[model samples]
Target chain A: MMEFLQQRLTDLELFGWDEYINYWFFLAMMALFAFELIVMAFKKAVTWNLIGDSITNFITLFAYRFIGGLIYILFYLTAFFWVYENFSITQLPLTWMSLLGCILLADVIYYWEHRFMHVCGLGWATHTVHHSSPHFNISVAYRFGPLDGFFPFFFHLPLIMLGFHPFMVFLAEALVQLYQTALHTQMVKKLPRPIEYIMNTPSHHRVHHATNSKYIDKNYAGIFIIWDRMFGTFAEEDEKVKFGVYPRINSVNPFTVFFHGFTKLGKQLWEAPSWSYRFQLLIRPPIWAWEQEQKRKREAAAAEAKASP
Target chain B: MNFFVSALSTILLGLVVGFALSLQKAEPPTEFEKYSSANMDFATMSEVGYAMAAFGRESTADYFELKDYQEYVQLAQNDHAKALSASDSPQVAASEAQASKAEAPTMQLAQVEHPAKPKAKPSLKDWPKSVIGIQRSTELINVEKVWQEFASNSALSDQLDSYTVSVFAIYSDFNSDYSRATISIGYDKPSMKGEQQLIPKGKIETLLKPSNYGNNALLNAWQDIDYSKAVKAVVERRDYTQNSELTSLFVIYQ
Candidate 1:
């Protein structure tokens, strides 16, 4: 059975696994959309507004797949190959053990990368596009910035430099991503106890997408739920999850979804009184800017009151 | 050929779905639409703190007291739920405003008192005396030439091109003072000639060790040196080029 699986994997690898997966991915997406329509008919589970969201999300995914790939080729490939060749500690061969090792390591790195995106403002600017949609469904899963993966290339570079083949590392990442895409749903309420306990489930991912106070930035696992559980970042799905970015996207414009955070950052930078505040606007968590703005408003109010008195 | 066919079909399928979606009429605005826009007025400090903490950034939580922490989180959660529910009618919106007014005390407190900033001590000076010695390395023998070499080096030439070389040290817990550690590279070089404490000068001893501090090795290293000490340490490179070294020395220091 192991040999058969490995053989299939090798054949798929030779045939370009990502492309092969892409063919199936579209089919699965259509099936999911159809399923959502059925569920909505009976239960009012989705809306026409969500369809518009899904359409915009589809545009992002299309751009990310084609244009993002071109950008990666022009910028990332050469440096990545150089780093792997020069700096890698050990070269692991293609075997079951190595593949498993690569997958596990890739997931660990992904957990951190996911957490970093939530923690830092620069990352949040890129990643907030995914969370902008107020509705949570399979369609929202594809709603990420076109160039989102560029920054994460550096994040995953360590895996390649640790002697895992870049292809293996990326393959593992693709598998992880495929698993995550499955996660962006409301249909599967919660899986079985063991599955929920071990792997990232729809329930856990809902909490990640939620802008509810309890859920804002929790459950940042890629494959395993254990990373969040072990790392003190875990929150159980006790409260009802409110999906979308906090201070939600008003427009369904794909360009607005893609560049809103950047636009906000640019505005903040222009208005900022100090260089430090401007830098903080660029690098601090998303909330930091909001808090600073509140502070400035309060200060201005106090000054106005004093002047009037 | 199969891949191209499949990819093209998928793209076309997406376009079809998108066109269908665009044709569908948008639903009326939900009652909660007012609260959907990102606004600081709606968010509490505790909410912000908890949000930051939820992202594994626990340091932001330092400002909140234990009492305020629970109260703020509870209030924030309640406010969020209320905002979500207020869209039912004008009556609910009125009640939501009242409820928001009730929650304003904490928000007022947050505005009245600015939280204390984290102290900034030069990383080198604050270095745990246990950092018995410091070593500095360069790609070129001449310290001045190192900057030009880094600038020219293809690997280190990018927009985000910065690297760190640890000035390694060996310190024993048993010997608190004068535990012998060598300053490995550039001890006699022009970089080390000035009256700078850049190199470990005398018996380097400190109260803290690598294990004493938090897991962030970078933050710990940053706190180890004073601004002047760091300047002194890099005095040689400053003369040759305006650009700073990509090297960062991350030592475990309390």
Candidate 2:
């Protein structure tokens, strides 16, 4: 039985089943989203803003796929195969057990990567786009920033070094993303207690998307919520969630939605007092950068008044 | 309008950078090559040693054939001793003697070298006489017609039996000047193992010349192939050694 399963997995890996699964899941999500729109229409909640927002979401998705496709073909494949062939500690065979372990590990890695996106200035500059949508739906799950596809290389390449096949790692990453995509909805409030405790549900993800002070930077899981719980980043759904980033973008234009975070970050870096401050604005937390910018402005105004007197 | 301009400019810059990086054609380092490169730093040396040790411990299957950790450690020690012996000089020998007296057991362990083992080559008498070869360019070739022609010739396909065959296509970077072909024949009956032979580029060119395939238009069509395209052909025959159960020929040309 085990051998049969292993062979099946090997065949699946050979035939690029991961890509097929993702494509099928995408179609299913689109169908579900169509149903969601119908329900919204019945409830008299479907508005032009919501329609425009969803369209922008798909536009960002296409832009991301374009850049991502190039990077994957040109950079990721070569680098991954090179490292796996040369530096891997051992060549792990494709078994059901190994695949399961890889997916679990990839989930843990995603949790940290997701948390990094929330806390670090540069990560947030790319990641804030996903959370910028005022409405939460399946379409919002498709929303992506310009550099969203680039950052995973830093976080997941270690799996290849540790002997997991690059294809297996790719599949695991895709599965994690697909699982999270299913979480981006207002339709399902919560799952059973045990499931909500173990897995990342829509409730947990809604909390993650919320800009409320209590929910900011919380529940950064891709599939399993256990990492967030263990890392003290977990937050339970309590108050009504207010979606979108702080100081909202307030535009549904695809370009605006996609590039707003980076534009805001760029302006801050430009207005920064020194080269070191600009560097800090990149690596430091966004909130910390904002505080420093405010301090710098106050000091500049004080200096200007004294010079005028 | 600003967004479109910026996006296009960024993509153009990315394409330029990606193309430049791809042009370098960096090859992955071999095991000993990694160790040699790591010799520059103490931390890297330790890291490489640990990684190799870990690999030797974990991979003991058919592909790697690393028997055990002790054998792996002994191999490393032997390699170190050989290097020391090759570079020995009078002054170095004296320093080595002094260090040996100071650290006898460690010195003794480092100085022990094992004799290289002679590998037993399989006798060709047990192998099949029939050989089939195919050439492919960028354009697809009809492999079935070539196989039928070879089989009907009787000179190369006298053995009558069943078979299993696998074909693989290998393509190198367009910028790379090197072109070679690899042929491997394996047996599925558990008694015989596969062996690989690499045919050189010059030999391949000679075999595929137009004069060699006179009156055979199918093979002649591939004679005008460009060498700069990095085309590779793989010929595989499986289960042929079974004598009664199998006779196989497989070829991939790209």
TM-score of only chain B in every candidate structure: 0.18, 0.20
Model 2 Cα lDDT, one tens digit per residue, B5-26:
5335534543443333233322
Q: Which portions of model 2 show Cα errors greater than 4 Å?
A: A1-8, A11-15, A300-309, B1-254
- Computed on alpha carbons, the lDDT of every model, listed in order, comes to 0.56, 0.61
Docking class of 2: incorrect
lDDT, candidate 2, A1-309, per-residue tens: 544334323312322456567767999999989989999999999999999999999999999999898888788867987898899766565545556667877887788788778888999999999999999999999999999999898788877776677777888899999999989989898899999999999999999999899998899999989877776779999999999987899999999999999999999888777999888878878899878767878999999999996
RMSD of each: 31.0, 20.2
- Looking at candidate 2 chain B, the ten consecutive residues that score lowest on lDDT are B104-113
Q: Which candidate leads in TM-score? A: 2
Kindly report the interface RMSD of candidate 2, rounded to 1 decimal: 17.5
Compute the DockQ of candidate 2: 0.02
Model 1 chain B: which ten-residue window has the lowest total lDDT? B235-244
